[model samples]
Target: MGDDDVLATLARERGRALFGYAYLLTGQAHAAEDLVQEALVRTFARRRVGFTPDSAEAYVRRAILSTFLDDARRRQRWSGVRHLLGRHDEPARDPAPAVGAVLDVRAALATLAPQERAAAVLRWCEDLTVPEVAARMGLAVGTVKRYLSTAGHKLEALLGPLPDDETVPLTSGRTRP
Candidate 1:
């Protein structure tokens, strides 16, 4: 398909799902929508990534993730500059109580370093295997495994223990604690 055609089809077929994933990462409706649209332009129109139709969604998902992380880092740097200039905003309010565990998990996920968060989300949320996540994130399998390990400990520290079913799988050369 041509660039516009491919983007049109992806938006028609996967738009809601893509927006939902972006929303989970960003926690804002307008930002989520904009992120998905931006990802489409970068992935398809710009041809920044080579892809087959079968892998298009995965590629786009990675684009969304990378874009989100990039924006986050940019915002953090800008915030630091503002702080240095003696500007401050009031502390933000906590999430509504009704949102509870999901929000807590999201908050915990935010506390993680980027690589750990990406590894944990891909392995546990996206249900990718170690080797698969390694390929997706362009890291070695051992590195992915270590990221999962560090993310697990960090998450457990922040949120306490997870249920057995929620635990990440140990790598082949590793054993569970």
Candidate 2:
């Protein structure tokens, strides 16, 4: 196959996984899609005259990581201003009864620092080992462990104790009796 055909085939096979990875990083589906597209575009632009498939996947993954890190930094810079605008102006709606558990998890996740959130997502959601997460996040294993521990503690505090009953409401604002 021609070089373009090979590239297209590889993208077709890996695009969904790439998007999923991006979503894990950004926590927003639309932003994740945009990140994946931007990463692919940047990777294609910097493509070498003769690159192997093995090298290409590594390159793409690196590009995705760079994009996510850069985007995080940008968001951090604007977060203070965004927070000042406040959430009170937002529209209200009925909460999803079934998704209360999911929303509780998301809220707990939001309370974590960015590195902690990333560490938790990489370790749990992505099923990456501590060493693997450290490598991917460019941190030491000790640092990753600390981040994960901090995240777990914060989640426990925010979520409170788990009830004996598995069917207990996660966000119903009621303590187990």
The prediction achieving the highest TM-score against the true structure is: 1
TM-score of each: 0.44, 0.42
Best by lDDT: 1
- lDDT of candidate 1? 0.83
lDDT of each: 0.83, 0.78
**Between which residue pairs do clashes occur in model 2?**
none
lDDT of 2 at 156: 78
lDDT of residue 132 for candidate 2: 89
